[model samples]
Target: MPYRHYLLGEDQKSLLDRLVSQFTLAEESHGSLALVYLDTFDWRLHQADLRLVEEDLCGKARIDLRHVDGTLLASGDFPAKVFAWDFPPGSLRQALEPLIEMRALLPVARLGGRRDLYAVLDRREKTVARIEFLAPQVRGNEDNRQALPPRLLVHSLKGFAPEARRLADFLEGPCGLTRSETGLFDESLAALGRRPGDYSSKINHGLTPALPAGQALRQVLRQLFTTLLANQPGVETALDSEFLHDFRVAVRRTRTALAQLKNVLPAREVEAFRKEFAWLGSITSPARDLDVYLLDFPRFQGFLPPEARADLIPFRHFLQRHQRTEYQRLVKHLQSSRFRALVCRWRDFLEQPGGLEETADGMKPIDQVADRRIWKIYRRVLREGQAIGPQSPPAELHELRKTCKKFRYLMEFFQSLYPAEDIGRLIKALKGLQDNLGAYQDLHVQVETLGRFSREMVAEGDTPAETLLALGRLVEGLDRRQAEVREEFSERFARFAREENQRLCRTLFKSSSPEQA
Candidate 1:
């Protein structure tokens, strides 16, 4: 596998304590790892091609090298001796050779014996080092990816490990090859002729930090979830993709927490939590699907002519009404205090020394806690639903619905632990059920939104045949989804629902062993 190495800089001058050459194998193409020390080199940065830098994840940066080619090209201490220009097509090497002659080079004598200072080494290794420098949080990136060779694309300072970021603190600046990146390059170059390893296992191992299975996995999840939540979908349709991602993560983590720290939780509790997550994922499916399909309509319409779009009214109208219905349900579930309480409760449960249900499922100000409480609420709903008729216990069902939402929230919250496949299956099933429920719900809401439109049309006295037709189409679509809930659908859905409910409770109450705890 191709291992990745990063040398992040807080400034343009990353004074990496570890030399680069020792980090790589002597061979031209082999993966190696280390954190050695090196000297420094002089490099120049340009006002052009700053775009070569990665997007600023450390907030923002001051390095702005604007150019038509969208690249910043300038020689730092390790100046490229312009021998030829036959590289990437359409390059400007030919036009800039005269300016790069050694005459144009700043004299080493005048440079105060800067004398190409670099990390001294006796061996060479094969490793590529990339660096990114972000300014202070107020204006993050200073050097970013600009100072290093373009091959080493700097993505974000935030992505760098803590130690790397600490090193970057000394590297960012107006100069190219932040002191840190320069130091790495100098070290690598210095070791050009030396053996790859110094023949010491302790030294090699100490140079590299290895993440253990326990905490490291959690960290990766945290970073990933942070990324997903940062970009919310515009409409419901996009929710599925996010839902899938979030739900799966929760599942994986749920399993991981269960297996790794078996002592921390009981097996039953882990199963209960997983089950609830599965159910929660199921209920949220229709809303996401409806949202996604409807939101994409506007773009899809662009492909048609005006006349075609005019006739497309019924389709668009149906989709819009569908959206309103799904939205109401989603909002109701999201706002339920029951779900909120569960999040706090779940967090408490997870953080505690005991297992999932050492205490009763309690409620709290949900907005204030981690997302798992909602999922517990979801489990609660299924339990409540088990006791009453779907129609007779409207109040109970409504509360049940609330619990379903809580589950979704929880699944989304602890998604870092869940598996993607598990979540995907649950989402598919929920979508199937939601398709019918969502339609019924949409009709329930659209009747109101369209009623006003109808009144307006009547007041204007317009011959709005399309309005009636559009409304009819939507109503029909809703009817169609419900129409199929017959023997086959009933059997399949019923079986799935039973299974889902079981899983919810199973997942809710899962636990681990004391030793593993």
Candidate 2:
């Protein structure tokens, strides 16, 4: 454990000298160090109580991992270039891989400073504790450094708590130093006018129940725009599949917002955006589909006998080749001027005040709008679900799936208007049903895709029979799973359509007048 005490007075050197005398300390190495704090745009590392820093000391670069409180966790020589995958195989990589899976590590703040290291000596001349006074001479944006006040740190070595406690008491009583509530990295960030949790892509508009429908929707659109822009860099770099996933989700939500709150925005503009985003969504789908198959390749292989699993290598290569081709197409389109203009126009429209002149019911309280829409969609879901029998056509189920998606989006958009617990229960129930339907549809698609691959391989005339056999087995396994999921659909839908959930939905979403506009 490490204990930290901040220097409160101007006499930091005096305080250190006093400590050297009182603890019978000896001078240790003292030098200048340049450090850069790193995190994702969303601060994933900091949120997990981890801090990663790249340090340059004496012309050597190293990365250090520490807790928020300044206790060192691990450190290793910095790689020549750092990527999410560059960390050598070790505990540090193991810890970081999950926390920052697909996000890039960005430098949050940079600090260049000098330190005076002192060791508290035991009677036997062994080091018992250590003290370092970090003098931050320059901080913030590297191009324009801002000098900051120096501060002292006390590090307690293991098994020497009593001695460290005594030194802390002396410093607090006579030296006038107080414990710092802020960490060094946080202080540096503040100097640069940033905070740990400043940015997030999650939709949190802080909408109120009484906000006008048009204004509330504009706020939602603004947030979605921000989310879309935030993920664009990741998508362009192909850092991870989630960037594209998030980008596509934002597009879908934007389209959904336009349709659901159609009356609030100008109909022509809304329709135009919907069409554009539909195109955007269409272009992004191939890459995302390929990503899903690549991600699920392991699971697909697991369905095959161990001895035959290697036979799927050709399929893996086929998927990768297609994924690369589709990803390149996606990147080219995303980087195009057309895509840039669309985002700018969408952003400008959403940022406009009062959002187009309100249509009939556009000025209604958002809660009222939400109540009417939620009740209508919920009823539609019920009507459609009830129409599905054991022998219902797959087309009917697909239609129900789309309805559930609309219902889910509405609940999510207006969630702030309702009791969170009640809305949560309703969404949960809907999700269970959606999951079953989604699985059923996805299985069918996968089976069809496998069959197509098998046919293509046979036409190529250079493929092995084992690969085809493996694809057949994979399709059969998926079919079996689809059948099982189909069998469970009744139970899942029953849970979603239970009396308790229905009562909650009706009580929460029942409207005062017929849904209008």
Best by lDDT: 2
Question: RMSD for each model, in Å, please?
Answer: 18.7, 3.5
User: Model 2, poorest ten-residue lDDT window?
Assistant: 78-87
User: Distance from true position, residue 177, model 1, in Å?
Assistant: 19
TM-score of structure candidate 1: 0.32
lDDT of 2 at 259: 83
**Regions more than 4 Å wrong, model 2:** 5-13, 26-29, 34-41, 53-112, 124-128, 136-148, 157-159, 191-193, 353-355, 454-465, 511-517
* 1-517 per-residue lDDT for model 1 (tens digits): 0012234433223332232412221222212121111110111212111211212212332122223232344212222222223212223333333332211211111000010112122235212223322221111124122122222223222233443343333233322333333322233323332222221111001111132222332333344333323322312233223343344344344443343333224456556654654544455565655555554455434444455546545555565665577666755654567545544555554454243234222121122122233344445544564564434423443444444444543444344344546655655655554444444444444444445545554565643576555544544453454344322333443544787645743453233211111
Tens digit per residue, CA lDDT, model 2, 435-497 = 999999988889998888788767766778899999999999999999998888889888998
Weakest lDDT window of 10 consecutive positions for candidate 1: 107-116
